[model samples]
Target: MNRIEKKLQSLQEKKEKAFITYITAGLPDMDHCAKLIRAQEEAGLDILELGIPFSDPAADGPVIQDASYRSILKGTNLRKCFELVDGVRKDGCELPIVFMMYYNTVLHYGLEAFAEKCAKVGVDGLIIPDLPLEEQQPLKDALAKQNATILIQLVAPVSGKRIPEILKDAKGFVYCVSSMGVTGQGASFHKEVISYLKSVKEQAQIPVMMGFGIRTAADVAPMKDIIDGAIVGSHFINLMEENQYDLDVAKAYIQTFKTELK
Candidate 1:
């Protein structure tokens, strides 16, 4: 098993769900991004969904869109992201990092090139939000050859009857979106939604971690036993944005956020 598989296995043994955090690479700069990546593991981040900014991110909401813009302004690119991952690994952090990006970035970077670099740079998983399953076979085959980076897919309720087929080949935990809309903090966790998620978890062979629109600790309460974990992006990015001038504050907030998982 790769780092992520080992992590989920370990979490299952401890009866604890994974606490995944998302941050856009080079939000302020790669150096700052690197520091936060290291700090996240220290603050109990089980998985890191590191974003690679694209010129246009259709699935991203205003917060992440602004974050991508900031990262791009600071010169973030796929190459820089790989370099940052290399540095993070060298810094002795093995925090099951996954790249959450759009398919346009992959196409521009070349699918095989991206896969090869992910294997070399120690990325445990790759999530291309815009890549359709019908178009994923070639990319999936390429990643399979790379042998390290797992292709993580995002699923919403609208995926409908094909959920099982979509997850059959998933290696790492599947990312289940919390709502139908784009990433944000206003998503509801009502009983009906919780029931739907529990049903999805029942069908998934791999751990199902929900993301997008999931905002706070209270939001995690209802997902117990049903989801293996919760994935937070826009909420996380917003926290960092609020603390941008002082990373120390941002880092402390991350530690506090981890406490909410229980």
Candidate 2:
């Protein structure tokens, strides 16, 4: 099994929920991004979703969009992201890293070449929010050849019917969007979120991780039984921005969510 699948199985055996943390690469700067990743690993995150900043990130909220813009301004591109990962690996950080990006970035890089680079750079998986299931086969084939998994997203309620098909094609873990809209914090968790997770879990053989709008530990506390993992992006990005490269604060915030899973 790949890193993500193994992580899910380990969590299942331990009767624990996985804590997945998301952060934009080169947010404040590349050095800070590396530091933040290490901090997350030290904080006990099971998975790290490294956002590859794109010029136009349609699936992201204002916070992540702004972070991407800042990262671009600071010279964080696909190639630089690979370099960042290389630096992390050179430093001996072996935690699983998933490249979270938009489809346009992949298209610009050429799918086959991108897959080769990802494999060489040690990326564990890919999460392209804009890539539809129908159009993913070629990229999937390329990544499969290199032993990398593709993580697909399932938006809530409206797309629940497509869960079985999505799961069929999904190799890593299924990212379940916690709300109807884009990535951001919501006032509260909807009752329908749990129902949607139940529907997907019934049909999904792989692990299911919920993201989008989950900001606090309390938001994650109730989800322990319904899903395999929880992904926090906007909130964690917000914390990183506020902390301004102080990885300790980021680690503490992430650890708070990790505490909730227990």
How much lDDT does each candidate structure score?
A: 0.83, 0.81
* TM-scores of the models, in the order given: 0.94, 0.95
Kindly report which residue stretches of model 1 are placed more than 4 angstroms away from their true locations once superposed: 189-191, 245-247
What does the lDDT read for residue 261 in candidate 1? 72
lDDT of 2 by residue, 1-262 (tens): 7677777788889988888888989978888778878888888889999999988899888999998998899888888999999899889887889999988888889988998988887888888878888888888888878876555555466785676777776676788887766788653565587778888888887788888888876786666677888888888888777767688897787788888668
Question: Which residue pairs in candidate 1 collide?
Answer: none
Pick out the ten consecutive residues of candidate 2 with the lowest summed lDDT: 148-157
Candidate 1 overall lDDT versus native: 0.83
